[model samples]
Target: MNTFRAARFALRAKPTASFLGRRTYADAAGPSDKIRLSLTMPHQAIFKGTDVVQVNIPAETGDMGVLANHVPSVEQLRPGLVEIIEEAGSTRQYFVSGGFAVVQPNSQLSVNAVEAYTLDEFSIEAARAQLAESQKIASGQGSEADIAEAKIEVEVLESLIAALK
Candidate 1:
């Protein structure tokens, strides 16, 4: 009896477009629509369920621009820039070290990053100095672990410099 009930529940039909309260993907992602976006990091939540016109992310596979009602998927982000266009047509740019972004069924995008900061917050001089130091360490005769760490730092600084441009 329990098994039969479980099977029946599993086979239940999904509401169709004609259902009075059902909303289709096309209806939700109509032109000029916005999606809810949440960009979070370990220490801060940049945008918390804020409605935005669009978001551009640097995914491992490739760069992608997300709009409302995009097919649900998970993308691994690379160290690069994330651009957000707000409802009022203002744009903001952030540098994310790396992260995971998930697009949900109801037009919600959640990004979890290890570290992120607005472009304006970064100083070009500081980044250049760091990049130079990292390059020296990476190219010098250092321990394998130190060299590896410096190499990672170099990659991150290069990405930051590109984003600053």
Candidate 2:
């Protein structure tokens, strides 16, 4: 019984380095060569002068975007959408209901969002419904705080729907 340590898949600038992890590799880049990304756990990473992203839930507020060249920002991220444009030009979108993003220019992006889900796995209809519902809540009897939160929800759902395409 071989207990696997990690399964990493990195998309290099070209098509050369693909997947790298474990011993039994099936691609040209499978944990064999030295790839730039060192990721642990799915859809997240620690600050190794690299990028970090995350997602989660709670229906707190809205969505945010954090890029590598983001000017070292600090903000309280409300749940919604997290778009990741890899160095390889590949875009990976996530839905985050609540969390925050810490960014640095040409360096890294650290995202900690509550309840994040990949846009590729997102449901458009569901997102649309959520958007509509949140909009209503935000516009209806929500307090200032509630409205702010609903706005975040709407943004996140809308962003997810857009990214899925």
Mind giving the per-residue lDDT tens digits that candidate 1 earns over 85-137? 99999999889999899988777889889988998899999999999999999
RMSD of 1: 9.4
For each candidate, what TM-score against the reference? Answer: 0.79, 0.43
Model 2 ranges with Cα > 4 A deviation: 1-71, 78-81, 87-89, 104-108, 136-152
lDDT per residue, candidate 2, 1-165, as tens digits? 122222211111112222222233222322222222222224655323443332221223333332222223444665455554454556555566555554333324455653666666767788788888998998998689999989877776765666666
Please state the error at residue 106 of candidate 1 in Å. Answer: 1.3
The lDDT leader among the candidates is 1
Best TM-score goes to which candidate?
A: 1
